[model samples]
Target: MKKLNCLIGAIIKDQNWAVIPFGNTILEPDDQVIIVTIPENASKIREMLEGGPVRTNHIMEE
Candidate 1:
């Protein structure tokens, strides 16, 4: 996950088993992860989770 404001929802590991997770939380197999982000960083966040090459931050002042 990028260094942006992310709201992770409850993680359901098994039937009737769910808990709120934090940033430092470690995910386990069969864990359901939910995330909410802004439109601007949607692609960035997707690439990050997919383990793809992310674009570097650049400033282009017209």
Candidate 2:
């Protein structure tokens, strides 16, 4: 999660039905994440999580 911000500047502002995120926070199957980011990065992050993990820190899956 820390890498998500440090690498792409997108922030996980808050999440529903989940714990407050820390550096090692792990997203579950049904967790609804709230993020603050630009539209392009939002799309990229969505694609990565929905599709699969990618090499870039900009898109972290799980």
Candidate 3:
């Protein structure tokens, strides 16, 4: 999530398991994730996460 300026704090899988996320973690199709980000970026991040088009040209270059 470095690209989106957010961190994935944890992931809950199948209503029975919770896993802390790491840089190399891979999310499953039905897994629920917890993301931590600033309020300013929430909508953009949501758009990206939901498979909507994001205008990367507007992203601030870190």
Candidate 4:
């Protein structure tokens, strides 16, 4: 089984809110998606979602 990490959130559509799960489900442009994916696939998921990882100042702070 593939382990998927997902973000639980609601999306507003036409004055209505809908719940979405991060998986193989189809998503609309105006729909809020909860990105659920595995650790190994995290890089791919991020790339697909927000184009790329958001740079943080604490990345190398440790």
For 1-62, candidate 2 gives per-residue lDDT tens digits of 22233122222324323333434344444334555445656665565455433222343333
The TM-score leader among the candidates is 3
Residues 1-62, candidate 4: write the lDDT tens digits.
12224433444567685764655444454444344345666565454556323221111111
Q: Candidate 3 on 1-62: residue-level lDDT in tens?
A: 32333544555555664654544454555546666555676676567667523222222322
RMSD of each: 9.7, 8.8, 8.4, 8.5
Candidate 1 lDDT tens digits, 1-62: 23323434455555554554545455444445555445665665455556422232321221
- lDDT over C-alpha atoms for residue 26 of model 4: 43
> Each candidate's lDDT (Cα)?
0.45, 0.40, 0.50, 0.42
- Give the Cα-based TM-score of candidate 1 against the true structure: 0.41
Off by over 4 Å in 4: 1-23, 51-62
| lDDT winner between candidates 1 and 4 | 1
Off by over 4 Å in 3: 1-5, 14-25, 51-62
**What lDDT score is found at residue 35 in candidate 1?**
52
Which candidate leads the pack in lDDT? 3
TM-score, ranked from best to worst: 3, 1, 4, 2
